[model samples]
Target: MSADLIYLVLGLALLLAVVLPIALSRCAVSAPIVLVGVGAVIGLLPFDKYGLDPVSQQAFTEHLAELTVIVALMGVGLALDRPLSLLRPRSWRGWSLTWRLLLIAMPLSIAGVALLGWWVMGLAPAAALLLGAALAPTDPVLASDVQVEGPSVTDDHDEIEESDQVRFALTSEAGLNDGLAFPFVYAAILLATAGPVAEWGLKWVGWYVIAKIAIGVIIGVVGGWLLGKIAFRSARESLAVARRGEPLLALGALLAVYGLAEVAQGYGFLAVFAAAMTLRSQERGHEYHETMHSMIERLEQILTLMVLLLLGIALTNGLLAALTWPGVLVGLALVFVVRPLAGWVALRVGHRSEPIGVAERWAIALFGVRGVGSVYYLAYAEGQAVFPELRELWSTMAFTIIVSVLVHGIFATPVMRRLERIRAAAA
Candidate 1:
């Protein structure tokens, strides 16, 4: 096929990918479904019309997903309207779900999969651990249906209904877990390039983990606080940049906080989220909050569609060619079994305001959709170190991701709708 023809086809594909899905939004499916389908079709059409061949450029894939993730992280930060205090029991309940999921469920899921990778898949310990860390961060792209929407409001009189505690906790947890998962990935990389396993045991598993988590939180909090002050105070006073109604200024907050946190070797994911919370706290009743969130959300949706499309192209072009039975099995186990078990265990403590019914809890557990974070982790790992079974690992991760996307994507709206109905009926 001619280059011009390929370009024309790609342009058309992009247009259809965007327009058709928006038209279908009420049907409970998404842009992802359409994009993935279009990408797959384009890949099979005997032309190089829609391939992500640039992914063959290792640095490109590494950075594209990296950039995509951090951008999404910024959006997540900008959307949160809640304060981070755990004082009220309702607030504390949200935090409880978050902590249990992150501290207990996340690690347990990682460790279980790591063990499976080691024993069943016969991967090296480092590689196995890397897989665990890579899969740990639930992708916000697929979990958007359950996430909190818009900014926090301080005014009780403004009259917007608050997002449910479950949604807020899950959304916020996904935001920061991406960064927290990084330390484990770093540990795996360290082990991959280590001299002695014992030294790694002490330095990496012990000191490094502690230091990284501490630094990430500290940098996020401090950086976000300062950035919030500048955004609300300096900008308001200067009047030169004081467009109080425009939320695009939230973009400034995203960049400033994310940039500094990374420079300080902190988790940019955490920093972006903390910064959002900080900014929300600054002017809780400000009308700009929703405007900012709306803008970020639209951009996030566009990015998500593009990523999902590219992922379909990747898969259609044999991204899973190297996946062994064991590798594939492990990935499936994670989405279907490991996560569900861990989620159930984590929430077993019972909700402070009467736990969700078994049906709702199960629905929530099963929909821990894996998306962009797995892509970022795979690309990040590829950058840091090479593994003997890299192709198998990549294929497994991609398969799991695709499966999760389809399964969860198709089910999210329906499940959420049903849950809401159930709650309403009970009330």
Candidate 2:
């Protein structure tokens, strides 16, 4: 590829990223599917594409996935309209389904995948655990079609005006689970390097499971509270950024909160989300929320496009060469079996607590869309420890993501649309 052709390709990809969302808005197909296809086509041509090798260049892949995830997390947090207060009890009512999905469904999914990876795929315990932890969370980036569209400001702060349980649950689950999945990832790392569960289990439980979560939430809340004051309630006339109509504070706030939490040895993903939610809580009816959210959403779109393109390119250019029959089976099973079964089991609680019906529950169960977050987790884990089946892990994870993008991508729009119609009729 010539320099000008490279520039041309870059410009065109950027254009497609900006336009494809609107183009595919009414169709069953998604922008990700199209982006992947485009990249695959580009890969078919004779060009030097070794620079985009994910397996060889793990750091680049990890950083790419990490940036996309954090950006998407910020957008997800800002886009959610549901009000969640950890300190408030009644507020928990609205988040019952979310809680169930995170506490029950996510873990069950992880265990199921881990078992399959170990039993059927013949992976070691640590590799299986890493696979489980990586694929466990529903991604905030690619599942946008099924998530809350954006934040809706209302006068009532206590109100959780959630008409779509499917979107709300999936969105909130994606947001919190990205950070929540860290404990298990850490567990996998310990199993790999720190020895068996008997030795490191207690330390992992206390530090990775408990302390880090607390630290992340605290940093997020404190940082968000401070930023909220600075943005919305600053006593000084010149200091209130939200009052001054600067929406970039959303970007600044997410980065600051994430960076601070990580520095404090906390889950930065959780802190970014927590800060975003806290910042959103203030000035509930403010337009600044939209501005900040819009900025995050735009960046998220660009990053998602880039990642998908690279993934598509990799898919065509020997990314799957290490893939075997077992890898394929595990990947397919995760998409078709483990997630839906686990999600259904968890969503049984929804009947009594949530307003969703059978179809909605099934939709929620089946639409646990996996994307860039999985990539980030796998890449991050690879950096921390040496798994014997690292190549196989990459291939299997890539296969699962592609299948998910195709399967869930094609069906999400139609399924959610039908459910919306049903909800409207009931209303």
Candidate 3:
């Protein structure tokens, strides 16, 4: 591609980033569908120079997806209106729906998908586990409609205005599970490199699961607490820096938490989210939270648009050519069958309060929107090890993402709107 062509494409993409969301705001159409459609159309224009090969550009694809996800994770953590709580039975009611989804729904979804991949899709154990882990976390990038808007302010520190159950559930689930899914991904990697689970089960459980999770949580809590103190409280002499309304500080914090956590052999996803949540809690009613969130949201929007556009281009350029009937079936099953079933089961078993009704549970269960997270995991794994069925894995993941963007995207606005109305009426 020439420099001029690149500029033209970038200009058009930036224009779409501004226009599409406003145009599609209250309609059945969604920003993702439109952005992807535009890219598909552009790809079909007989312009050989515009196509991208995701498999060939794996590192670029991984990093782009990684950046977009971390940005979204920060937004997710900031947007939450509910406070986090411990998982004791006495405190279960105080626990957020995010807890149920992470502790219950996510594992069910992962297991269901892994079994389907192995038995139904005929993938090997390692590949099946990888597919499960990759598609397990709900993508924050494409789930804007189902998430809390931004930082909410209230007079009483203890008064958390109840968010709509569906939004809270999805937002919390996506935020935490993005990090929680990492251990399973590592499990797949270990299995791929070292042969059988029997050989690495003990080490995987010790290092990948327990140790890494502990390190990530400790780092996130400590880092987030210190950053919050610096940003929100600091010496009077340095208070000017806190009041300058620099939202880039949020980005800086995100990078610091993520980079340091990863360097320490911890899960960066969890650390980034934990830090954001901790920071938000520091000055829960601060206008600066809104400033920081809005900044992250805008960046997330642009990156999401770019990724969906590339996905569309890749689709048009035969990304799904490797798709088989079995792959298509598995993809459809994941969105329409497995996720909903797993979500419903989780809620049924886990929910203790009367806050979430059947309709809310069903809506939350049905809308497990998977997008860039799956792409990142796949790309990251593909870089680490060779899988003979790489093409099929791509085809399955791509097909699933397309279905999610279209199906969930089309229904998200209308469904959430109706749910909000119902909650308001009930209130």
Once fitted onto the true fold, the runs of candidate 3 whose alpha carbons sit more than 4 angstroms away are 1-9, 49-51, 85-93, 236-240
lDDT tens digits, residue span 1-427, model 2: 2465446456766898778977998999999999888878777877765555676778988988998899898898888887778788887887889899999999999999999999999999999999999998999999998999888765665563667888999999999999999999999999999887999988998999999999999999889889998888888877788878887888888888888999999999999999888888788877788889988998898888878877887888888888999999999999999999999999886567666688998999999999999999988998899999998998899999999999998999999889989978888
lDDT of 3 by residue, 85-139 (tens): 3333553465446677888888988898999899988999889999999998899
How many steric overlaps are in each model, in order? Answer: 2, 0, 0
How do these models rank on TM-score, best leading? 2, 3, 1
Which has the greatest lDDT?
2
Worst 10 residues of 2 by lDDT: 1-10
User: Candidate 1 lDDT, tens digit per residue, 1-427?
Assistant: 2465446545655576457655876777755666778767766767654335423546757666766676677667656655564234665554566777788778888898899999999999888988899987787666777777666555663454344655666777788788888878887888788745776777775555776566666766676667556655674555323245656666776777678777876667777776666666556676666777777776676666666666676677777778889987898899889998988887776565446678766765676778888878877787778677677778888888877777777877787788778878887
Model 2 stretches with alpha carbons more than 4 Å out: 1-10, 155-160
- Candidate 1 TM-score over all chains jointly: 0.89
Global local distance difference test of model 1: 0.71
Q: What order do candidates take by lDDT, descending?
A: 2, 3, 1
Q: Write down the RMSD of candidate 3 (Cα, Å).
A: 2.0
- lDDT score of residue 81 within candidate 2: 82
